[model samples]
Target: MTTPSERAARGREARKRVPRSSHGRWIPSAQRPDPLVVLEREAQDRLPELVPLRYGRMAVSAFAFLRGSAAVMAADLAAQRHTGLTVQLCGDAHLLNFGVYASPERTLLFDVNDFDETLPGPFEWDVKRLAASVAVAAFQNGSTKAKAHRAALVATESYRTTMRSLAKLGELDVWYQRIAADDLLPLVRGDERARVADRIARARRRTSLQAFNKLTETDASGARRIVEDPPLLERIPDIDRVTLGKIFSDYRSSLPEERRLLLDRYRYVDAARKVVGVGSVGTRCFVLLLEGRDDGDPLMLQIKEAGRSVLEPYLPATAYDHQGRRVVCGQRLTQAASDIFLGWMTGPEQRHFYWRQLRDMKGSAEVETMSPDTLRTYARLCGRALARAHARSGDRIAIAGYLGTSDVFDRAVADFSLAYAGQNADDYAALGAAIAAGMVTAAPGA
Candidate 1:
């Protein structure tokens, strides 16, 4: 293993290769592919009927467009030079992606919750994505351009400061780092504390029993079954039951021996097809309902289709051949603690899927309606959470050294965020234009 001095030197060397100030640049290249074409390609593997819904969601606003178009940004980031320092990226680290969730230990923690696009790549790519999303959100929420830039800067600055702090810690301590729920409110204001507390309470109430009550009902025969909300949540037909058994068996086998025993305690009650996420609408997603010792005990697990990462084409080939395993591995490495049921399996059509609890106190902030102060504070929270995650998978010493004790990197990223926010607006309008021109059909409000 290299000494800390070498790692620090390595980080500084990367600066000479790619100047920190160069990060602020964002002029779309002449050869840049059309954003619509990129979205079209992404939709190819998705459910055809839901394609329009994805487009509709992306057309909602510039920030929504930024959330759904990770591939477009991946391609754009690929075109730019970056610090060679790399880490497991939260492939789509938008404002909404950071949230509060329950750890296996039953402690509430704030962390990066989405991992559909997770992959190893240059560290700055995730930072840029996070910063750009903040800028887009600020604009959408009616913040002035200057206020937006300040919010974006706060995010990058928090990231830089957090990474630097982590670099001074011991290896095990850094690995064990997590931003607990208690750390959140102090970052926000006094009156807003109630709103923040209310969100947490709501998240705590989002349990399997709550989902059971809301999503299922007893039939004439007294058997409980999932209610069908056609297109969004549909019952698995009789013909697919046998295939479902095979899928369950495979998923169970993928778990650890102890987890396999834990799996054995629960009997599968029902399963249903479900649509989820703005960008992942068309993917094959399913909610599995299981019963424990009695009628009072319930567990909900979500199995979402995992495809090749959007970052895959831009970065070097990922080591894992299975996309589901790639996502699971990235999450395991980057998260402070992972869900007990997290596993991957191959289904009937050979599509890869990863499993996790449907709801374990999972909740996100209301970004669209946030005041400028709340948004900036929230931006800093996301930035710090993201840095904690990056430090887990990358060399904090090198990353911190490259970042140095200056705001140069932070300010440069903030500038890039504003410029890219403009580009995102243009792309958002382009999608709206395409829908108007009948180039693509959009389902009304999905």
Candidate 2:
């Protein structure tokens, strides 16, 4: 194996190919595709009736637009050169995607929770997406441009510093690194600590039992079932329910022998087609309710369709034949710890699907409600989580060397984030205009 110095030298050499400072530039090319067209094309295979809801949700705000337009940003990032440091990317690394979730060990951990568009590619791409999100979120929350830029800077600086620290560790030490939820409280200042603790408390309460109480109720016959909330949550048809029931077995087969036995103890109860996430509005997603031990015990699993990663068009082809497996594998590789129920299967018409707990202590920040200081603190924490994630799959020493002992990369990414936030705002307006002109459809407030 090469020494740490050799790896560091290699990373420094990459600067010659794509200077870290060059990341600040964000001149939209005249050839850039229309944002609406890009979104529509990317979502062509989705359920047609629900497409309008996606557009409506995305129209909520400029930050909402950014959240839903991962493909749009992917295309833009592809237009520019990138550092060749490869890592399993959380293709949509916006601030909200990094949150608290329960690991298999029942330990709460802070890490990247979403992986809908995961794939291996250049490391800086994820950093740019994160920085851009921090800036957009800060601006939407009413922060000044300078404050927004500083918030974005905090994210990248935290990432750089975290990566540098991880680089000094041994192999197993780096592999075992994780940011525990309990450890987060001490990091926050006076008033923020209580708020952070409350969020964690809320997440712990957001279990299958909480979902069982909120989502299900007794019918006249005394059978409990999921309540329909129109366009957002609807009970699946009996036939569709049967199809998912069969697919559940296939998903179970993907798990380890022990997990399969653990799964067999629960009997399938009920299911619903549920809408989730800003960008994932129109995807084929369903929730399966299962009962174990007694009627009081419940487990909620989500089976979501998996399509090609948005980055696939620009980066290398994924090695997995099944897209669902790609998502499962990527999630397993990047997360410090993964959900116990994680698995993948092929559904009808050969569509790909991955299953995981619908709500295993999952909690995300309410970015719009955060004060500027709180946002800055949260942004830095997310940055640290992301760096730990990347170090698991990439060359930490090289990444640390590329970042160096200065804040140059952080400042450059912050500048890019601010510049791209302007591009995102213009695109958001264009989307609204399309809806008004009858070129696009939207079901506002859905």
Candidate 3:
């Protein structure tokens, strides 16, 4: 049998054959133009196009707009790659993307929960997105630049150090150990330690049963149901609903025999239209209520519309043809444990989407409500988690070799973050201009 180290070496060697390039060149930082300048132009082009989609709904707050603005920034960041190696990335890995969800083992694990835009790209693209998010989040919370810089620096340092450490570990070890709520206290500082402990205690109270109770209700006929309201939420149109019903019936054929058996035990109860997340609001989404042998026993599944990955056209070349499949596969590769029911299905309309439990003991730390010290601690935690996720898919040794022991990369990220935050301000101004010019309908408050 192969030793674990030998197995890791083989895995690493396999990765070496995978193409790693950015726009066909290895441009270093000094040679690259300011990423912020590129971001501004992309935002000017894309953000105006999205405004008409907002309609009469309350203009999503500035913070919410920033989340959607990632596509613009992603385009710019991809154009300015300083490093040659890139890995599948969580395109908008902000502080909020780090959250608590149950692993397959039923343990509450903290990790990156969204993967809609995940794809292979320059590693620093992720780091830059994360850093700018920290700045935006801190600014929204009234944090001073100095304090925010301190937090950003801490986050970048944690990422650099954690990636280096993972580089030395056996591949399986790196893959198996994920950060848990139980690990927070040791890394927290001062009064924030007690606050983090309190938060974890609160998070622990939210179990699957608690989630079921909060989201499900029984109708007058005593059938378990998910209620819906129109515009914000509604039943999916009958034509599409019928088509999806047929597609889901065929979905069983794609699953393994054992998985098909498990799914066979439940029947689809109802499907309701739902809107979700800051960036995903306009996309088609639905919640499927599944009934087992008993009427009261329910399982809720969310089927979201998946589009082409924002990174696909930019990627050099790869074996995976479907961008949605690439996302699901990448998520499985990076997450220590994922939802057991996680799977993908395609519709007659040719759209692709991945499905999973709607809410299985899912919760997030309220960063806006957190104290500064706690925010700093949480930043470090998110940084470490991001590093671990990257290590699972990238060349850890080469990354570690590039990062070294010094704080150069950390400091560089901090600098980029400060500069990028300024760029976000400029983009936000341009968005305001588009709204003022009647080029697009602005949401109520926006």
Give candidate 1's error at residue 17 in angstroms: 0.9
Ranking of all predicted structures according to TM-score, beginning with the best and ending with the worst: 1, 2, 3
CA-lDDT, candidates in order: 0.92, 0.92, 0.68
Number of residue pairs clashing in candidate 2, backbone atoms closer than 3 angstroms, sequence gap of 3 or more or interchain: 0
**lDDT for each residue of candidate 2 in 254-353, tens digit (9 for 90 to 100):** 9999999999999887888999988998899999888999879999899899998999999878899899999999999999999989999998778999
TM-score of 1: 0.98
TM-score of each model, paired residue for residue: 0.98, 0.97, 0.83
Show where candidate 2 strays beyond 4 Å: 240-245
Q: Cα deviation in Å at residue 187, candidate 3?
A: 3.3
**TM match of model 2 to true structure:** 0.97
Model 1 C-alpha lDDT per residue in residues 1-446, reported as the tens digit of each score: 99988998999899998888999999999999999999999999999988888888888889888989999999999999889899999999999999998898888899999999999999999999999999999999999999999999999999999999999999899999998886787877787988999898899899889999999998899988999997889998653668867987899887889999998999888889998989898999999889999878999999999999999998899999988899999999998888889999998899999999999988999999999999999999999999999999999999998999999999999999999999999999999999999999998676
What is the Cα-based lDDT of residue 371 in candidate 2? 85
What ranking of all candidate models by lDDT puts the best one first?
1, 2, 3
Q: Give the candidate number with the greatest TM-score.
A: 1
Question: In terms of TM-score, which candidate is stronger, 1 or 2?
Answer: 1
